[model samples]
Structure formats: C-alpha cells, structure tokens
Target: MSLRVLVVDDHPLYRDGLVTAIAAMPEIEVIGDAADGAAAVRAAKDLAPDVVVMDLHMPELNGIEATRQIVAERPATAVLVLTMLDGDDSVFAAMRAGARGYLLKGADRAEIRRALEAVAHGEVVFSSGIASRVLSFFAAGSAKSALSPFPSLTEREREILDLVARGLTNAAIAQRLVLSSKTVRNHVSNVFTKLQVAGRAEAVAQARDAGLGAP
Candidate 1:
C-alpha cells in the first residue's frame, strides 16, 4: 500500500522536486503539498496523511512548531524534517518538538524514501552527519552524569541500552548477547518500559543523559 504523505516547504521549486522524486517510489503517495507551516498544519488536518515532509525554515509557524502542534493533535501522524539546518540546536529542537526523523536537504532519493518508510513504521531516522552529532552529544552527557544519582538499572538492561547507544539492530544485539531475537526484542520492550519512553531512540537518549553508556 502507498503511504499517504504531505509535503511542506517554503520554496515551490523545492517542493516540486520532492514530489517528483517521491512519485518515483511505489510505496508512497503525495496526498497534498503546502507552501508554509500554517497551510501544512491545515492540510495535514484536512488530508489526514500518514506522514509529513516538513522544512524547518518557513514563513509562518515554522516546521518545529508545526510539528509540535500536528503531533499533539494527531499523535499517529509522523513528521520527517527535510531541512537545510543541520546545526546541533536545530536538530535537537526538531527532535524535542516531536519530529520522528531529520535529514539534510542534500540527501539522496533513497535516503529520503528510507526515512519516510522508517517513520511510517514508528522508527526514528537521522542523516549520518546529524546522527554523529547526536551520538557525540549523548556520549559527553553520559560522561558528565556518571556520578549523578538515579534509579539503578539491571545488568541486562544496561547491556541492552549500551547496544542501543551503539545503534545496534535487535537481531545484532541478540547475536552479541547470545539470545534469541525474540528474547532480545522482549528485553528491548522491557527496557523502554523501565525507561518510560516510547521508542529505542528515546530510551537511548535517556540512558545517555544519565551516563549509562559511551557513544
């Protein structure tokens, strides 16, 4: 089934280019396009798309604020930010505002497609450049919080979280831990519950902030 998507960006040509590229993918459908953040929010409500391709810099509302509102109003709709801003602050802002994915504007069609698909499947995705920055930021944070007081995690949970910080797949972690893939998956679920977060990325972020692992 084609995933319904809403494209929002300030530049008409850029939006057009994105539509053209996305049209080539068989599993995606561009339900509508918006020229600004307000329009994006309205169209998102009207169209009820499965995902939104949002640009960070816009004339009204802006991507981060729009994402925050859309996510708050429609928790199922995922937002993938495709923007020129790759700075640490912008990346963090987008994530904090409920974006499920972030990627540079220069990303190739495959990368964009993968991000959309991942977010649609409730997974967080990031460009390699921004991914490195986030990882390093978390690593430094983990170091600083090494002495802070927090609830103690079981040894198994810590091991699982260390693999999460390394961005390991469930199957990869299972192989390393010498457990069944299903068992590792269950452990991951338990870890998220213990951490009180929704996804792998959030769990890893919390662990890093608490000085649980190296990047």
Candidate 2:
C-alpha cells in the first residue's frame, strides 16, 4: 500500500513544490497539506496520515510542539522534520519531542522521499550532516563520562541524569527504568539539586560535559 503523507510548511512555494514532488513518487500518496503547525495538528487528527513532513518555524504553533502532540495522540503516525534550522538545540529538541526523522531544507526530493519512507516504516532517519552531528555529540559525551562522573549524585540519580542528557523525557526515563513517573520525577529533582542546576537543560549541559549520556 502507498504511504499516506501530510505536507506542512509556512512557505507556499516550498510546500507546493514539495507536494508536487512527493505526489510523483510511486509508493507515496499526498493526502493533505497545511500551512501552519496548528492546521497541521488538526489535519493530522482529521486525516490520520502515516507521516507528517513538518517544518519547524510556523505561525499559530511551532513544529516541535505539534510533533509532540501528534505523537502523543497518534502513536501510529510519524513526524519527519524538514527545516532550515540545524543547530544542536533545534535537532535535539525535535528528537525529544518525538520526531522520527530530520532533514535540512536543502535536501533533494530523493532524499526527502527516502526519509519519508523510512519513517513510515517505523525507522528513525536523519540527513548525513545531522547524523554526523548527533554521532559526534554522543561520542564526545561518551569519552567524557567513560569513568565514574557526578560524584555527588547517588547511583540512581546519576542514572537518571544520564537519560536526561540523552534527551529523554521524565515519562520515557520512567518507562525505561521501570519506575513510576513520580519516582522518576523525584530522582530527577535530586539529580538537579545535587548538580546545582535549576532545570533539565542545565543538567543536560553539565552531564554531557561530564560524558554521562553516551549511547
């Protein structure tokens, strides 16, 4: 069966061009299109497409939050991020928000089609440049935390901190560790307190610097 897709972007020309290009693919079907994240979310609920080709910056809502909501509401649907932004913060935020694939705007139609196909099949995908960045980030973090780090934190707290640095949400961490959400939250709080950080971002920065979140 053809993969059903929803194309979303703020730019009229780019969206139309992408829709045209994707419609030409043999195994993909363009079911709908939306001009903003809010409409994208509504369309996702209404159309239930197999994959969403999402752009990061949009009016009414942003792609990251839309991806999070869509994934939460429709676990069967996948989000493929296509954006101009390639900064570490943007890439990691999309991953944390549950995007299944990421590609820069410069990616050609063939690459985009491959990404769409990959995500539709429940596989994670990224452009070569983005993949390199992700690998380098993990490698550096691995090297830094090769030995025991975060001496002040208890073993559990340290474990939680590692997951946090890996960009997992509290619920994801809880699921991975087979702990209650409340217990995960409490451990994360302790990790923050011991690390002298006020929030997850700060804690992640510190933990990654100490090599805690290696794959």
Off by over 4 Å in 1: 142-215
**Per-prediction TM-score:** 0.66, 0.67
> What lDDT tens digits, residue by residue, belong to model 2 across residues 1-215?
99999999999999999999999999899999999989999999999999999998787777877898899889999999999987655676677778999999999988998999999999999999989977875688843332346545677888899999999999999999999999999999888776555688878865775567998
The alpha-carbon RMSD values of the candidates against the true structure, listed in the order shown, are 15.4, 10.6
Worst ten-residue run, lDDT, model 2?
A: 142-151
lDDT (Cα, 0-100) at 204 in candidate 1: 68
Off by over 4 Å in 2: 142-215
Evaluate model 2: give its TM-score: 0.67
- Error (Å) of candidate 2 at residue 22 is 0.4
Model 1 residue pairs with clashes: none
Model 1 Cα RMSD, Å? Answer: 15.4
On the 0 to 100 scale, the lDDT of residue 35 in model 2 is: 95
